[model samples]
Target: MKILIVGPSWVGDMVMSQSLYKRLLELHPNVLIDVLAPAWCKPILERMPEVNQAIEMPLGHGQFSLSQRWMLGKSLRDNHYDHAYILPNSAKSALIPLFAKVPKRTGWKGEMRYGLLNDLRPNRKIFQFMVERYVALAHSKSTMLSEVTIDDIPNPALNVDNENQLACLQRFNISPDLPIVGLCPGAEFGPAKRWPEQHYAYIAKQLITEGHQVCLFGGPKDKSVTEKIVKALSEHQKSMCFDLAGETSLVDAVDLLAACHTVFSNDSGLMHVAAAVNANIVAIYGSSSPMYTPPLSQKVRVVDTDINCRPCFKRECPLGHLKCLNELMPAKVLDAYRDLNRNQNLE
Candidate 1:
């Protein structure tokens, strides 16, 4: 069997969608799976062993150029894909599969995509976790959705590039002599999802004091956020802290993250990437809830405040106060890290 998957746009969602690819390979051992995703996702898709190829999407996210979609889809006809799994819920996302004339096209129901998707799953929310929803599509439409458990959805495990990992460590002058603590304090969603910079700086300082080196990680948009955290740290702490937020590429960041002893992050892309790499993770949740999208890693600690208005899932806080994140003190995160460390030692 041959398959074509229209992958998710966001880094985290793209990473999580690996579960679906993995499930497909298990069901059909010899199946060839190719993913159609944004150029940004190429670095991530390359890490997945199940993917046969990573085809770049010409049209940008939210771009609805009918001519472009038709041409791109027409171009794929020669590949003779037997099936296509559209991960995004939008009607536009399903166009390529239809235009390509794939025998079967599957996806969750959303936004006037009735004719676009042939094997539509009506209730995506039935599967609580995003990974569950993706993996469920791999099963036949005749199968009951409720029968699929969390265990059925495989955790995404990205293959580390050891050569690139070494090059990044040398380029950044990061030594493995001290235990490395990676801090991912950026959330692409918005301010509501982000933990305070001061809190992150406090954590970095405390970890450094305990003889661990800290590496700040994020995309270019998050450079300011990481800079603020660095600014709050003392010169001595600054020397011990390496702010590589905007410095490293996504692929390079993944390599470096795999080398960390532990990773502390907000509910963001890097958090999911850290989990995929099998790093010890301290995931801090604010506007988002872990119940919906927890880290898939076994070695993970989820830190969140029990606030009434939290999990609002808003870009910015609807209310003036951001108690969900603000009230979540740095000490609480450190405590969670300690607890996770203890559990690992016990095991």
Candidate 2:
């Protein structure tokens, strides 16, 4: 069967969506699976073995223009897909599949998409992990939702080659001998999601004291935040940390991250990428609850407080203290790091 999956635009959601693609491929190995995704997340879909093609969705956020929808619809119709699975909840997300007139359009019944999706799945009774929610769409009406464990999902294998890694290292003038620990300090959601910059500096300093090199990673918007993190580290510690935020492309960032022994990140895209590469990850959660969207890998260790106000799911914290993230001390994170290292050495 030829299938088209309308993937989520966010990095973490894209990573979680991989499980669904894998389950589909396992059930039907010969099926041609194409993904419609944002340009930023195309690299992620390209790395998944189940995805045959990654079609870039050009329509920007907010209300889609009628012309763009018609154009997209016509383009999808030409592909002749038997099935299209809409992953996002937005009403516009279902338009292309409906426009293409795919035989089977499946998704949860949100945004009142009665006409858009032919096979609407009820989510009221199914309270499970986000990965399971995505994968369940692949099941037939007769098929029962099997209990899925972390083992059922495969790790994200980045498509980057060794030459790409070497080139990126050379471009940055990064020494091959140094042991790198990648630090991703920015969370796009809000300030409530970000751990204190001084805390990161403290952790980086500690890592350097232990003779490990540190590399900061983030997008262009996070350049100032990354600078603050580096500046806060002690002068001796500063030499050990390289501020690569806003400097590297997504592809280059993946390559550089793949080279790290471990990655410390806020609950962001880099955290998911680090997990894809099977790097030992320390994922910090703040305002957002980990229950709904924890890193989907055993290689990751999540640190979060049991604060009542936490998991508010808001862009910014309603309370000024921001204790959900603020309470999680750097000492706790360093402890997790030590434990991860010990386990790795034994393995």
Candidate 3:
């Protein structure tokens, strides 16, 4: 069977969707899986062993012009796919699959896609995590969603090779023998999700004092924040910190992160990557609730204070205090790191 998966656009969502792709492969090992995703996420999809090829979807804004959609649909029709799984909820997300005239189109019953999806599934409330929701779609209506577990999902792996990891580290002058700690301080969501810069600096300093080198990771937009974090650290701590924010590509960031002993990050793409790599991860959640989208790895340790107004799901704190994140002291984070390190040493 040939399957075409309509992938989610967001980086983290794309990673989470891998769970569904994995389950499909497990059920039908002989099946060939192809993904339709944005150009930027091609590297991530290409890395997955289950994915045979990633078709780049050219999109501008939420809507793809009728002409563009027709062209894309034509291209997909030529592939002669047997089935298409639409991951995104938008009505437009189903256009290509419908136009391609795939034998079977599957997705949730939303966006009023009456004629688009031939096998529409009811959006059940049994699955708590978004990843689980994505995976449950693969099963028949009689399948029990409650029985789905993390074991059913495919673990995250980088498409980049080991040689690339070593080469990237060498190019960055990072020594292999020295223990590395990764810090991801940016959240594309908004300021509400961000922990204070001072707290990040404090954690960096603590890690350095404990003899670990720190690497700051984020996009070019976060360069200013990274510089401030480095400046806040004491001279001794600063010496051990490397500001590679905006310097490394997403593929390169994953490779470098794979080399780290642990990663401390807000709920972001890198955090998901760290979990996929099975790195010891300290995931800090703010406006976002852990219950809905916690890291999908056993090695992850999530920290979230039970603030009454938390998990508002807002981009910015409705109350301005941002206490859910700000109240989570640096000491607590440091303590978690120490505990993780001790546990790893015992193993």
Top candidate on TM-score is 1
TM-score of structure candidate 2: 0.95
lDDT tens readout by residue for model 3, 1-347: 99999999877888788888878978888999999999878878877777999999899548659888878998778789999999988889998988888989988888888789988877645677788778877877577465576566666555557898999888888878999999999998898888888899988887788888899999998888899999998877777899999998888888888889899999988788877777899999999987877778877778888889988989999898999999999988888877887888898
Model 1 TM-score, 2 decimals: 0.98
User: How would you encode candidate 1's per-residue C-alpha lDDT over 1-347 as one tens digit per residue?
Assistant: 89999999999999999989988898899999999999999999999999999999988989999999999999999999999999999999999999999989999999999999889889899878888888999998778475567875789999999999999988998986778999999999999999999999899989999888899999889999999988988889888899998899999999999999799999999999999998999999989988888888889899989988889999899996989999999999999999999999899
Q: What is the lDDT of candidate 3?
A: 0.84
TM-scores of the candidates in the order shown: 0.98, 0.95, 0.96
lDDT of each: 0.92, 0.83, 0.84
Residue pairs that clash (backbone atoms under 3 angstroms), model 2: none
Backbone steric clashes in candidate 1, count? 0
Q: Model 1: which ten-residue window has the lowest total lDDT?
A: 144-153
Question: Which ranges of candidate 1 are over 4 A from the true structure?
Answer: 144-147
* Per-residue accuracy of model 2 over 1-347 as CA lDDT, tens digit each: 89999989898789889878878888898899999988998887877777899999887656678778778878888889999999998778998888877889999878888888888877623635677678778886445356444456554565656788899877776776888899999987778889988889889888899898898999998999999988788888887788998998887888888889899999888888887777889999888766767776677778888888878877788878888877899999988988987988898
User: Model 2, residue 181: what's the lDDT?
Assistant: 91
Clashing pairs in 1: none
lDDT at position 35, candidate 2: 94
* Better model by lDDT: candidate 1 vs candidate 2: 1
TM-score of 3: 0.96
